[model samples]
Target: MPEYPTALGASSRDSITLLGKDLATDVMGEVGFGELAFWLATQRRPTPGETRVFEAVLAALADHGFTPTAIVTRLTYLSAPDSVQGALAAGLLGGGSRFLGVTEDCGRFLHEVLVEREPPAGDDGWDELALEVVTAERAAGRFIPGLGHHVHKDGDPRTPRLFQIAREEGLVGPHLSLFAAIGRVHPRVLGKTLPLNGAGVCGAALADLGLPLELLRGFALLARTAGLIGQLAEELRHPVGNDIFLSVDLNNRSVPPSAQGGPHG
Candidate 1:
């Protein structure tokens, strides 16, 4: 028999047993989620605040009505009653890319305002900045990331609440003030309100928290997992999850073969 490396081998066995117990108990308190994830997978702990960052990020991304992702959750529940996890996984597969980089972008925007010490005079200054940014981005042929929303013609309901929370929690500082500036600016520019949507607020919050840009999307996913789970549970109680989304597919997909004269099946 070949000799096993007792030193490292013993440590590996210890890690496995510890992780197994931790998993069974859901004992995430002592070790942060980021550290726990890393330790279980690679026997290394996450640095610091990685877990808190993970938590805030997850909470922020938890739900936003029935986007494609939420729709998939409902559909999977309708099709497979017992497979809640499966439904959630399916929904997550469709989670939008828009949510991923939100925190980073918000942070950058706030950072710009902070570094520049440029405080807008009420809403008008805000509008001018928005116009300048929009015009520049459009002229440059780049898509504007967050401005107007589809469902929220005037403003997003989610953004203001988040800002309020940030202010109450004393988390709002430089970035938050900038977000306030953005909110005030919305009504002046497009002659319509542009309440800070979830993505934009999340951006500011993440920046304030000092989390890196790369983690925002992952945070969104973790946050949304809660929504997926809730949606799955809700879907279980009634047949309400039964709405055919073929139309959604139709709208999102490529134009159908030059509108070929008739409804060819």
Candidate 2:
């Protein structure tokens, strides 16, 4: 016989233990889902400040108003009302580069840059470093993760609020400092100012909180899970999926198969 060692959760005939505490008594009503999530990821309890910041990240990502993820979720549900999990999974699967994956991309990008150098002494130093980074990225023709927002061209509302919250909590680490500096200095290199989008800011904040860089997107998905459920709830009440499908189905024009190749071909 072989045994697997574990510290997360265990059940014995009459009792359940999680993170070495009574699951029913210590974890049920006493622990919040946000704090628990952080704890589960780090295997250590988070401070009140950490919990606040982490929960804010979750809230920031929870919904974005008819994003493709929400649309796919609703459409999937309409196609198969019997599989709620399928609908949710469909939405989560859509979390890639242009959507929730920005959280992870921004965090990892910032971390990679920070690890290559020492921490800056102040905003001026950070700004200088940011400028050099932006210039190099521009020269390389690479997009800066978390640089812009399609909807909030002027600014991302969530970006500043999260920065304020992190500042108040004294949890603004190097990742966020660098991200803010980038916001200030990128315009000089790119020749245009772009809002630091919410997903990108969430990535910076999560990195500052010392969350795993790889799992950053997982957190985004976690937040969007709530949004997908809300989308489904609204879908049940308002029922727009069929209309959306019909709109495209009815409006699309059919052309010869040769057109698929290209106009010149």
Candidate 3:
């Protein structure tokens, strides 16, 4: 069984081992929390420089306004106090797929495209092989992954930045180049240039960074959870809020209640 380096030791309450480093801190943000977070995941305790990178990432990904997931997180907090974790969890579920799930698929695609090449095929061959693989996969009842996004018809801006960072870190290798080759081949659908989205680029970058496939989503969850908390906190601050707006009956249908529910007279 292969172990996940990114997920060596993660506990719900405190501590996680990143890159052979042990990080111990309370759940609440405290002094040197950022340092602790980096140490936990990357081992060897983060240098001031490394800690700076981690902080930048944390801040950049912390929150986006009124995204459905963000909105849901804030709304959850308005009605129920002490559910910050729960609200964050809900948002995390939506995001993990795009970050980790998509990354895994993109990595797979990148690897396949590389394997399918013979004798260092040129750009044309890379595209040709990718299209062939995609068509064959679709024919085999598998959808081509990391090719589309719900929000952006043209492209995902975040994708390039992540790739650029990974490249600067010397992490992008054959795996990423393979994915880039494929990404460039995608002709615009709906008259839109569908560039590699967050999932695709992150997927390739993580693979090149030597992260395990199973641990991709977990890392992403860890990162984005920070943002979710911020949204929850912001929503809680505003007083004018109709928090409990559950339209249970708006599209509700009554079902037979049995063991779970006592008789309501």
- Residue 145's lDDT within candidate 3 is 63
lDDT at position 15, candidate 2 = 99
The runs of at least 3 residues in candidate 2 whose Cα sits more than 4 Å from the true structure, single-residue gaps closed, are: 259-265
Rank by lDDT, highest first: 2, 1, 3
Q: Is candidate 2 or candidate 3 better by TM-score?
A: 2
Model 1, clash count? 2
Against the true structure, candidate 3 reaches a TM-score of 0.64
Query: Lowest-scoring 10 consecutive residues by lDDT in candidate 2?
Result: 255-264
lDDT score of residue 133 within candidate 2: 92
RMSD of 3: 8.1
For lDDT, candidate 2 versus 3, the one ahead is 2
CA shift at 160, candidate 1, in angstroms? Answer: 2.3
C-alpha lDDT values of all predictions: 0.61, 0.96, 0.59
Which candidate achieves the best TM-score against the true structure?
2
Return the top candidate by lDDT: 2
TM-score of each: 0.62, 0.97, 0.64
